[model samples]
Target chain A: MEIKHEKIKTNLQKILPAKASGDKWDLHLYIAGQNPKAVTAFNNLKLICEEHLKGKYHIEVIDLLKNPQIAHDDHILAVPTLVRKLPLPERNIIGDLSNKERVLAGLGLVDHSELKLV
Target chain B: MKKKERPSHRNILPKSPTSIQGLDEITGGGLPKGRPTLICGGAGCGKTLFAMEFLVRGATLYNEPGVFISFEETEKELTANVASLGFDLDNLVEHKKIWLEHIHVERGEIEQSGEYDLEGLFIRIHLAIESVGAKRVVLDTIESLFAVLPNQLILRTELRRLFQWLKRKGVTTIVTAERGEGAFTRQGLEEYVSDCVILLDHRVNDQSSIRRLRIVKYRGSTHGTNEYPFLIDEDGFSVLPVTSLGLNYSSSHERISTGIPRLDTMLSGKGYFRSSTMLVSGTAGTGKTSIASQFAEAACKRGERVLFFTFEESPSQLMRNMLSIGIDLQPWVKKGLLQFHATRPTLYGLENHLTTSIKLINKFEPNIVIVDTINGFMVGENQTEVKTMLLRLVDFLKMKQLTAFFTSLTSETENLSIPDVDISSLIDTWLLVRDLEIGGERNRGLYVLKSRGMAHSNQIREFRLTNHGIELLDVYVGSEGVLTGSARLSQETKDDAEQLLRQQEIGTKQFGLERKRDAMEAQIVVLRSEFQAEEAEALKVITIEKARNERFTQDKIKMGKSRRGDVSIKTTGTKKKKYI
Candidate 1:
């Protein structure tokens, strides 16, 4: 998965252009602690948000280990789970954000090819 | 170290007892405490119930609150399902002693994009435990996560961690899993939760479905290895522990009646020992059931409770049939001294019958139990199963000190030395009633084939089913070899005729002896008369001679009278000449 994420970062950067809509993107990153996966997810998410929706996306990081009781609100099970709470319908995207293409589609920044596949 | 030296079982391990009947004994104390135990079974095999019962019993009975996390059933569904079993889940939940958490995970609801773990489930479980202060936890079918997550590697690793976490939490936990092919649990959950493993199965044998539970493995403890039949009823779940078949029951010296007075007399003037198992086997119409009913009647008459199990007949039908033989089973039933359980032998498997009977016995607490014709249970079952069932029942009854009477049917031509079901070895008293066919007559002959600890009658007594009750008469043993029925009647009549002929001969002999005595008396009189006549005649003849002599003497006397002195001298001279 890490190798795939590196391949996606190179390929998606060349194919994508910074195009932001007026609608604000609200994102919540759910993690148990600052593990390597969570750190990689945070870094990957920042890079994708800045490159795509630089000024339109708002990001909030919630550590489950400090407030473990709060994890049930979104039913977070994985470390580095990013939940889009502001997009009319809430969507949960679990796994490290290293897969930038799937993250872009999950955040609705890219064409929802994942939705079509499902 | 303390466990080895304590000489007591309580010192071994801390236990959380599930108050399910007979289960605590099988596990030696319930699931391992503060550890994860796996319960796996096929669908509808009662795994969920077993897990829920563990949680509920822990919370309600042990004063230890519990958390129930269901991955398949919601709180409402689980509550409703167990409500029928008399578990008030809603009430328990409201009391803060129980907490219900439903983890609703749908594959379509979440998309896998970033690397993630199962922190949400852990958090929710921890919250529920904290909320209830739980010492027990149940995760029913957590394998549902495997179906939804689509990530086996992560799920397996997390499952292992979850079990360790539960152990660290110090709460006795039950993780129910779906049974897999040739494996204890689907997804190999048994590998993670290995402290204790219980397998529940619902099997159909001979058209009867019996629910059984077995302790597949229990680490660091002793447990019964045999599969035990379990019952799920309105009262709750109960397991019929196989530990009862260990011959650990007590024996009594007290005697009970066989119901028939003469039959009692046949059995050493006493009947059966208290808590003894008795078998009355015979061919068709040989009054096997009659003897059983009579024993039940006797027990009821003594104001003792009796449970009569009839596999071949209905309760009312048995009562009426017994009534024909003058054994009224209705009054005792009405008085509650007798209870009748009528079921077909093929209605269920032997295990079901055994567990159901055990449940009934536990509830009724009867002093005597009568299984009319144990042959009913042997119809579709193997010999070993039948023996085990009967052995367990007898042990249970003996432990309770309750007399058990069973009747078995044998073929008319079958050997009478043993019973048909081959359970005679377990019986303390075996009464064999056979049809005595001799002289073209069939009579009922009842005798004790084998009676332990008593001097039972070795003679086969002729038993008749009279209108009053069963009557045992002394059978006639003659040259014809144990004459019975009309043969006995004819022999008795012949003896009476001989006696009458002997009396007539005695009367004739007396009359002849009396006539001989009269004739002898008359002859003696005649002889005495003859002798007397002869004597008189002799006397007459002598008198006549004397007269002639006297005339002559008179003349001489006259001459001597002239000379008185001469006469006196003559008398003196006569005397002297006589002496010479």
Candidate 2:
């Protein structure tokens, strides 16, 4: 939780210099319940979008407990899932998004680093 | 009412019947209810089919909606695969009786971060289960999760929790896994936590494949431990719990005739006991098939269904051959009283043969089953397998009160005292047909080697395959010991000739005696007449003498009257006595 707060603070500093990209970013965050991991994952995701995607990003928080049928659409099998549906090539990052670089690379935010996630 | 219907042993875990043909019996009732069952097998060993069938049976037969979460197969593929088994997954899903969810676990497309649980999967499965109110859940090949997720530690832990959650939901679950190196599954841990574990195997023995299942462990219940052969055909998945049957099948005292009256007479004037095992073992050309067909024809003629499993000959060939002996099977076939399942025994392994036979028996519901040439199932080094298969078949038939007839072909060199298949122990009646190589001729001879519970003819009869089926002529059992074929014919003719000659001699002796009696009567009659003539002449002469004596008496009386009247009468009486 403390790390997520620090990341958000850092992202706030970068927001002034960063300009929102032209492409709209639509992301869906799937979680089962209001657990700490989901909260941290949502916070970290919001911070990332604010810094990198700015106002052009759209985040949908979907609690699977509320509507579990949506899990099938995204094929989410793990909690704290982040699905980027905006781009033509969709990407999904599972878990709490604790590995910031891995998540960023997975979401195709930066140039792919050829880091083998497996 | 429901409380009264509950079992007396409340402690014994209640079971949800799978409704699979024979699996429930082997599992002692079914997998532990409300607990996960592990079905592990290698590729194409029917693990997926077993799990799918469980769900389908639960949904359709038990009124229990089910959820099938397949991690390995897509919904379309699974649907198409199960569709062949007559399970309409689409309809079931549409009706909300079953829920099919394909968990696409693409390892390349999935990225793992720290501190994640399988809450998403649980929620998806939970929602599907709730949507259908499923009482059955299947995680088909959940071991695939280990492949997609890099962190096996968390996946295993979450899976364990998932089982607990499923238990809490009180739904029967089936989790399929891949057969590992030596363990029951690739992820060997599933066998430990699952309430029951089934291992499926597809083995190719002697170039023929067979699928078998074994329950590695079933907690809180005693189950059959022997490996059971399972089949997946058009009718879907079925486990043959043949080994689970005991020898407690009820038997009948009612008898049935083998088509040949002589054979029936040999077998205690009745052919075979109903629900009994009849064995006909003989060498080649000894008419084993004929006896089997005869039994089948007789059963069919009695208006009972007959299943003729001809392993060596085609149905038409068998019918034609049987017709040569004047036993026409075509009428029975046309009348639908007899069904012929003719196939090469080599087409399947022993287990498949057993499964196929069982399927046919169950479907046809015959009163009699004839496995013509059971030796066809006797391949290289598989006698035990064939024996077990036949034992199971015989048990099944007996349980259904169907008489089972099996014909076995033995080599001439083998001992004829026992059945070739070493299954005489189970046979209720055993007929041994052997070639009588006597008098430089080979003739067929049949005798009842054994007939349980009734008196049977132990004497060997000259077994003839005449134009009118089988003819059992009494073997010549005189000083010649036992003669068959032309030897018996020749001996009988010779005996008749000897008897005729003796009758002719006796006739001549009787004629001579009659003539002698007639001639003697004529002589006696002539002699009596001559004696009568002689006696008449002699009486005439005596009469003359008496006249003379009377004259003399009269003169003497006259003289005596002068002397003394009393004395003269006495002298006259003395002279008459002298003349007499």
Best by DockQ: 2
The candidate 2 chain B region of ten consecutive residues with least summed lDDT is B415-424
Lowest summed lDDT window (length 10), candidate 1 chain B: B413-422
* Model 2 lDDT at residue B418: 33
How do the residues B1-580 of candidate 1 rate in per-residue lDDT, one tens digit apiece?
9878767665677778999888998888788899999988899988888888888888888899999998889899999999999899999999998999888776765667755778767888988999999999999889988877746788788888999999999999999988999899878988888889999898877667878899999988988999888878776788887544467777898998888988888789988898899998888889988899999999988999999899888999888988998999898999999999999887777767877887799899999999987877775636766776777777778778788999888886676523344677788998888898889889999889889999888998999998888999889887767888889999989979999999999999999999999999999999999999999999999999989976976686677678775435357469458659
- Please tell me the TM-score of chain A for candidate 1: 0.73
lDDT of 1 at B474: 82
Across residues B258-319, which tens digit of lDDT does each residue of candidate 2 receive?
88888778777877788888888888999988888777877887899999898998999888
Question: Cα RMSD (Å) per model?
Answer: 10.1, 7.8
For each candidate, the alpha-carbon lDDT, in order, equals 0.83, 0.83
Task: Give TM-scores for every candidate, taking all chains together and pairing residue i with residue i.
Answer: 0.81, 0.84
- Using TM-score as the measure, the top candidate is 2
DockQ of 1: 0.45
Model 1 clash pairs are A77-B117, A77-B119, A77-B120, A78-B117, A79-B117, A95-B114, A95-B115, A96-B114, A96-B115
